[model samples]
Target chain A: MALDRKIAYINLSTGEIRKGDIPLEWRKKFIGGRGLDAYLLYTNNPPGIDAFDPENRVLISAGIVVGALASASARTHIMSKSPLTNFLGSANMGGWFAPEMRWAGFDHLVISGKAEKPVYLWIHNGEIEIRDAKNIWGENIYDTQTILRQELNDNEIQTLCIGPAGENLVRFANVMTGRKNAGGRTGMGAVLGSKNLKAVVCRGTMDIKIKYPEEALKYNEELINQIISSKVSQTMQRWGTMFIYGTTNSTGLVRTRNFQLNQLVGGSDIECENLDKVSIGLDGCFGCQVHCRHRYVIKDGPYAGTYAQGPEYTSQGAFGAEVGCNNMNTILVGNHLVNSYGLDTLETGSMMAWAMELYEKGILTDRDTDGLRLEWGDDEAVLELIKKIATREGIGDILADGPLRAAKKIGKGSETYLVHVKGMSNLHSDERPTPSLALGIATASRGSDHLRSRPAIDLYNLPVQVLEKVYRQPDGYDGPLTSGYTKYEGKPRIVLWQELCYMAVDCTGMCKYHTVFLSPNHPNFPEFAKMIYYNTGLEFTPKEIWDIANRCYTIERLFNIREGLTRKDDWLVDRYFDEPTKRGLPVAYNKKMDRKKFKAMIDEYYSLHKWDNDGVPTPELLKDLDIADLYPEESRQERKGK
Target chain B: MKIKKVMEGARDGEIRCLACFTRFRPKRGVDRAACPSCGVQWRISWPYPKTARLQGPVWETYPKPGEPIAKK
Candidate 1:
């Protein structure tokens, strides 16, 4: 079957549809999904546009590789001007929705303008219609999904819906897909709400074109087998990502009590062994073999018989350790509640943790919390707060803006307890001991995150110097590369290399956990790359792949710099600098991060990239990437002025 | 009789073995042969003083499922 590339453009004001074929050159260079979204956002100059502006477009693009013979694990990217950072923001999510979009004969859907009334888009095999969503506008995410499925009379038709939080335009509202998978950053759901779009329901039967089915099938099968055999995969398969809970806690990187402490008293309660007690079976994305996703049931609690798809390691730490709640049942129920309501677990957990700290210190009381005592380790209180946050009821209204904004509103030394870096809450990963990882967290564009860089693996497994040397070496090193598991000197370089590699994985529509580090071990990556080449006819050597990755990463950095981001914005929380763990702990918390040394490292990083002192892309560098025309003129003035 | 002999050898200096369960010990060498009962190989660097050990059960112990285990 021939695949037609259909681009769906919705005008919010007129309810008119504009359909066009994806440009041939655009598809060739950008591929699809994240790559295409990045190209489109860059071309549109969505950066610096007010996130709520009608002109600000949110494009949901599915990769060309998705719904094909290739791994259907390919994602859908939500690209928009972020209300959270007021800069370029894109968050990708994996579920049935992306494949359904492909089956609907669309490569991407570009949504622009604001609808005058609440509405939902229904696309079934190329026919599109916008229906009034007045009845389901204020529903929770679960209810909205249920109602949409009933209304469409198709339970299998995958839906992406926003909750009351999104409908209320909460700055951190996440676009929830499937049951628990979410594009959970930069408030893409709020942008959807701004357009008065309640949900996107897609169902279709069209087959995606495959260039080489036999080779693709062979490569995919081999890849799955290799994953099943890997030791890391075995561990993940057993306990999902929660397998790392005990190890991360032992490594002193688990975010605890709102990043105040590196250790938790109840850390053992949520360990892999303990999680196995509550978990029923493994859950995974469509066509995923790793099955790292998990489903857990809370058999006993104030909220009993609650089952959730995940309280994945991040959620576990955020709800369990960060808030000082040790109860597995609480974490499970909390995960179910948040996932059902379609709230970002990271934000909900971090904000609730922050609230608990304020309550503990008597900064917040029953009066502030509307008669509910917010105490640390109180699972009941935590559950109440999660519900409130979702419904924007009581204390939830205050926390809907997230920790930084909530702290500002509730200021009376409340800001001191807030543990965000650059307006985004710290993820479950703590960055106290590993300075390289700390720097990565501090410098992450979307805020404090583990995914932007993979320095955590080094902290957990390798020494610093060896990681650095390996990074300094090119894509494929033949020398005695440092064991990434051992601590050595040259770590910053390794982190930089990993960051570039991650950029490629994200753009190419591959799962990072499976593709990047394990590539060397797997026999299928080379064949997988060959499959891409066969499909797109873009022959890319591994070196060329790295170059493309570097180009994408540099462009992302340039995008931020255009919006006036500086090295000063790249910084960790004060707790990392000042707090010291009690004696006998692995965390050497009292040691102050040498700002001068970190600045020197940044200088080295800039020089290594041939960028200017202020981290702007040089004219020569842009020309080398053949993206000279893509560099905005305003950025040129900003770079020249700097 | 063979198991007893192996245990006796492990306890005596003739064996020069470390506790195989905790591999961090011995501080130097390791025995090529594993324990007959546990299949754990003892490191050679550790001095096995005959009178110094055996206060508890020899097998590895862990918390059973749903049982509350002591925190690390």
Candidate 2:
């Protein structure tokens, strides 16, 4: 019944490795993976610790349910203090890495301190070795993996590594696994780079013991059956993230031309059909039946023979709509290039769009751009810019720092063009039209990310009955469409439920797309309980699991509070609230956010979390969640005052 | 420059846009086609499925509504 997962702490400065069981209490409170990792970061890295400091620990945890003989149990949680946002640095990646780590007899790895020289950790059968990565120091992510596997004589080893972008300390650099799956947000790779660590290669032969194997198998079959049967899952399997591009584009919510416009006028033609030309096959993470990741090849184009993993909706929106490039081939190339160089595609695309805006406005020119025209939809320039940013060459150097810092450095009123929340670049979906999405991103802990708490169902325009079925409410609200701007009644409730569910999904190591994030037919609380019970042998009713997820959410809120985040910091870019999204006569046409309505919604959202007027968790609520140890009552009051 | 128009009642099939080089399906009779990316308007003969754009199919073996979900 003991999960028997252990945490390995690696001190790079002293080259020491310490292994111990993760505290059972911590597991009981935070669940596993992201929840525990967040707690560890908050406990180990104190306030004002420099993100690049040796003391800034990067915590990695295989999800509690990962390797539990369930579907898609391949998720890993990577967290550290972000060099980019300087707030909560956390990212979830799906690959074979997490299961490999678990099978290697450890559930978590807390890497700290700077290595005296470039090194990669080799983990096998609960044993750890710090091997010199001197030869592979400057290699790209793909090359590093290949060379490490060759050097270690294990082609089957799973590797989590950084590339030239990480080594050079690009602020938006990410840690990549396989050739494509990246822990792609919040500059975790830069943290790895700052420590002189290159990679963590794992191979193990140990078995992941699960309770009630028969029941688990049955439930997993049922879950997969439900998932693959759903229309949403099937569409996802076919088009990957491309299935929704048409919807986003047609709705005028997709970002275009640095958000100078909302919709791409003729974007449907490019998005609807172009991807079919390149996708060779579909791929998935560990144990997933619904393989949603696209494996693509540019069979015949200027960028021919380019094979890569994905241009997820994020990349497509960034390259296609945000930068005004309708060419899907460029997105494939950009995805491949960024993956090789270990760059966060969303941030890279945002920075590219930012520079293009500056160019179009005459603020930056060919001279500043190193003679490369930084124009919208200039596919050649976008590709070149990706390389330059990764290598930190010319304007790429300025952009390598991400938009917030890059804006300050390249100030000709450049800050005005930045589409960011809390110093991180916004996701491609323009929130000006969707109040729930706007509020979700503004209050999201990791900054401008929808994965935290997006009410995607709100965009479906489903009827009141479907909304009631999905959201568990029947009377108060009509539907998502009817509950648009100025409708605060049901929006706050949906955001709250989604935030908790999302936090729980991440903690349990499930894909958001497979959960209620996308569709009502997907798994929810009851199914989650069955999965957890069969895997960990820990019985939790749906409500109990939700409470634990709430605790995890509060702990993250405290982590941000300790770093001085407040209600004011929760505001979005002025453009969302001010500028009317100008595009076509699409649904989101001329839609501008009403700031007061947004604040009122936030006020209600804060109340839903039992937090105070300024959005700080109340001391009583912290006690109820049993996380009063995180902040004493007076300290909570002090933070609230701030 | 004004785009040249094809006369109505032309043959039905696929036609490639000479301006943008993107292949697209045209309706029967004299069809006005516009390149989605470039907005270059063109007059073309009606084209059928054979001349459809080289885009990925949306539903690639995915279960349709009312179809049983894959058991595997």
Candidate 3:
């Protein structure tokens, strides 16, 4: 009834394994998945440890509600020190792997120490074994899955693996499962590769015993009915995330040529209609009713034999519009190539787009690119460069490290075009249009991530009463497009509410698309509390959930504070605050944020969270959350050796 | 786990290989077969699945999944 789950702590260097019950105290404070992961990673790893060091830990956590009857509950969180940012790094993915791990009787798997050689972990039922991966060491994700399925003789086995990009230490490498699900941010795969770990294959058939099963089922039925009837879910189920392409382009959110332009020239060619040309059918995650993934087949274009599961709106923004490529089929190809190599699509495309801009400006040459023409919309060049980057071949060695690192290596004002925050490449969204979106990216712990706190509903231009009621602000601010009320009053509250909701949703294993991400009418805090209550029999109010989320976020803030990030780190790139969008209508173009107002907004945000003016969680607030033990004053004194 | 078809009634149709993205007309029905070009095995059958010229998996939208074959 209390959710019986164990955590597996495996030391790869010593070939040792440890198992223990999750501390109830920790569970009460940091629910599970991303929340618990942040707590464990911050506590287990000190501030100045190298991301590649043997002491750096990797954590895989199944969500608190994973494997339950709830739709899209089959999600997992991956956490480690990111090689890209050298700070607290985390990502989440949806697939069957988390459910398999849940069935295997573990909610968290903590891995430490680098193995002597390449190795893979095999978990069957409750048994864990470390096995040699000599034969599958250099394989791609798809091939590795095929081989492991054959060798294990269990086609049903679920796997989480890294590909050659990770094995080669591409700083933006991602961990992948099934054919399409990827924990694709902050370089979790590179950490796995640094530990000489190849894959974790698991199979389990045990039943998950939960409290109030009937109540959970009833909630699931209600949610399914609601999700099916919702207009946003209906659109998502049909067009996946690509449904937003036209709107994003119209609103000056479709980033092109490394954020130099926010609108694509040939819009219709990169819209969902173009994606529809290749989308053969729909595919859903483990139990997702929205079915936002599309199974695409390239039957007629230059990339006519490509097949893959997605090209989510991110792919459209990354490969299609951003690279100046008008053909959606090429975007599908780029998606397939990136997935095969287990690279982060956003980072890869951003890097390529950055390099193309440099080449176009004569900052980089053919000699620098290993004689390959680095031009915009060159699909063949894009394909070849992807391979080179994955294998770290030729000039690809520099690009493999991501745009930030590559810019430093080729520093002749190339850093001027570097579209990143805190050494991580920017997402496809153009945040300059909205202060809330811009601030969200600036303060996200993982750096330059939108999922951390993108208040997707703020873009809907909802009625002020609805906004005021949901965000609890005094008034509905003027829309994000206007630089009036949104910049002054309500943005801080919107971002704060969004971050907590997203953190809770991530921990609870619910897809944000099913929540208030797309619209104000979707599920919210009370509904989440109800779901948790029915599933785990844990009596929690919406306020308690918000408190736990605050504690989790505070832990992350403490981690980043110790790593030397300050209020100065909580700002956007100069392009957003300096240069205006190159071309668009007068109302939507030549837009730049007021840096003074942004700073004031940050102050308000910090004050609301009881954080100091410097964005540090205060001792009084930590004590209020009962987590002061995590960051005693002596820790800072000890850092100074005083 | 792989899909376990009850096999109440087998129908003849074209099927595409997810592995190789090849579409072919199987001499024996589309329930299970191998791609002629890429040699990848496929067991999932679609509802009247058709490819662009059957040369290879080009960029084209095939028919949507049938109601019975849609659920996983």
TM-score of each: 0.85, 0.88, 0.87
- Residue-level lDDT of model 1, residues A59-124, one tens digit each, is 887766676655435577788777766766778777778878778778788888888999999988
Interface RMSD of each: 16.5, 21.2, 17.8
TM-score computed on alpha carbons, candidate 3: 0.87
Q: Which stretches of candidate 3 lie over 4 Å from their true place?
A: A300-303, A473-488, A636-642, B1-72
* Residue A522 displacement in candidate 3 (angstroms): 1.8
Worst 10 residues of 1 chain A by lDDT: A582-591
Error of 1 at A50 (Å): 2.1
Ordered from best to worst DockQ, the candidate numbers read 1, 2, 3
lDDT of 3 at A512: 75
Give one digit per residue, the lDDT tens place, for model 3 in A413-521. Answer: 9989888888888887777767888888888888888888888777655566677667762223343322232345568778888888888888887777767787676
Error of 3 at A417 (Å): 0.7
Cα lDDT, model 2, residue B37: 46
